[model samples]
Target: MKLPKELVNGSIIFIGITAYFLLMVILGYGNSFYLRLVNIFFVFYGVNRTIQMNVKEGQTDFVSNAVSTMVTSLIGVFLSIIGLVIYSYMQGGDDYVQSLSETFLFGGNPSIFIYSVSLLFEGIASSVIVTMLLMLYWNNRLTAD
Candidate 1:
């Protein structure tokens, strides 16, 4: 059975994010907030690829394309969060989260769960925004047959 283009693109996003984060840690810049923001490009690339594939395949319904783009981004976000949670626990659980909260937007010494949940919410919001923006760009470019 063939995998959906969204799934494949989403996995690519997740891989890119994982590699980028690991590279940051290796380069001693893991705590840099500005570097962290670069991860959004991975989501944008993956989501855009899904929409492009849909258009190439002649599936030009705006709603369906939007849904596909959202799903692609959400997959990357969910997987990345799960990886973050697991890595946090491996690196000292709440202590790791506390260190992260220092440089990140989170305040007040949150626990691992709280940090992960907060990130999940942030990821969801970004996913929605990326989806909308990409849909708007694609809508202007795609014409129904």
Candidate 2:
């Protein structure tokens, strides 16, 4: 039952995402499941990377994991936002945000730049949060390994 480092991380990410996706669905956030899944992948990857940190031999490198996760999450969130915005614009600018599902799609204002920035911030924050949780798990397992 031994798993390589990469497999372990990947498995963790896959399981985590599945759990989150199911939760979102159960909680009624699954209307745009496709979009949410795409966005969540980035967070999953980033969090998985964070969980890769190993300090088993009196070693510590939590900061590196934190940074990587932050960066990855940011990228994921940004990509998701971009997809949403493009979809929104295509559906018809002012007329698009009418639906409840579309309302949750996130198009802050008329400016693309502002929307981009907002998504970027969401990415960064999400990545940081996901990574932080992974880091805690990693740290705890470090000594047990």
Candidate 3:
């Protein structure tokens, strides 16, 4: 059975993010908060690829495309968060989260649950924004009438 383009693209995003973060750690830049922003480009690339695939298949309905894009991004985000939780526990649970709280949005020390929940909310917001922006770009490029 063939996997949906959204799953494939979402996996691409997850792999890109995981690899990028691991590289940052290996290069001793894991604590650099600014570098984290670059991961959004991976999300953009994956979501855009899904949209492009839909366009190629002549499935350009705005709502469906938007849903596809959201699914792609959300998959990446959820997987990344799950990975983070696992890594955090491996590193020392709350202690690891404490170390990251300095650069992360969480004020004061946070447990792994708190950190993961905070990030999940942030991810959902970003996914929505990315979906809307990409949908607007595609809608303008492809006319329904």
Candidate 4:
């Protein structure tokens, strides 16, 4: 039974982000520079895998690659957000929420308004940046005359 291409790519993104987050949690690296580095690495890894999957499926056009990367990145970001929420709730949601607000926002309280807006913008920007960077890499590597 062959999985759909989108499903495969989405799984890659979700798994990559989840793995990174889990590692961070296990290592107690939350809100650290190492966590940021790992996040960047996992995001690019997902984009790379998505591009590779596109090539494997013979959908290697620039648009296809870019779209796959963007879709996969978005899915990963969505899953990561969900995972974070779940983790926070599991680890006493109130304190987790306060920590996030203090860490990211102005250190007051967990304002759902600010958190949601920030995540939305950050996810969109991250998808665009990752897609562009991966497309550039693939174009230069795969389409050179």
Steric clashes per prediction: 0, 0, 0, 0
TM-score of every candidate: 0.96, 0.53, 0.96, 0.81
Cα lDDT tens digits for candidate 2, 1-145: 8654444554454455556655776888766736564646645664565444443333366676566555555544555555556655876754544442344556344355455566567666666677777778776766566
Q: Write the per-residue lDDT of candidate 1 for residues 1-145, one digit (tens) a residue.
A: 9998888998999999999999999999999999999999999999999988898898899899988999999999989988998899999999989999999998899998889889999999999999999898888776532
In model 4, residue pairs whose N, Cα or C atoms come closer than 3 Å (at least 3 residues apart or on different chains), thus clashing, are none
Candidate 1 Cα misplacement greater than 4 A, ranges = 143-145
Identify the candidate with maximal TM-score: 3
Write one digit per residue (lDDT tens) for candidate 3, span 21-63.
9999999999999999999999999999999999999998889
Q: Which TM-score value belongs to model 4?
A: 0.81
Give the alpha-carbon lDDT of every model: 0.92, 0.56, 0.93, 0.73
**Candidate 3, residue 137: how far the Cα is off, in Å:** 0.6
Comparison by lDDT, 1 against 4, better one: 1
Please report the TM-score between candidate 1 and the true structure. Answer: 0.96
Cα lDDT tens digits, model 4, 16-133, are 7777767776888766744555576777887788788778778768987787788888877777777767777787776766776654534667544456556767877988998898
Superposed model 2: Cα runs more than 4 Å off = 1-42, 49-60, 100-122
Query: How would the candidate models be sorted by lDDT, starting from the highest?
Result: 3, 1, 4, 2
lDDT of 1 at 92: 95
**Backbone clashes, candidate 1:** 0
Q: Which is the better candidate, 1 or 4, if ranked by TM-score?
A: 1
Shift of residue 94 alpha carbon in model 4, Å: 3.6
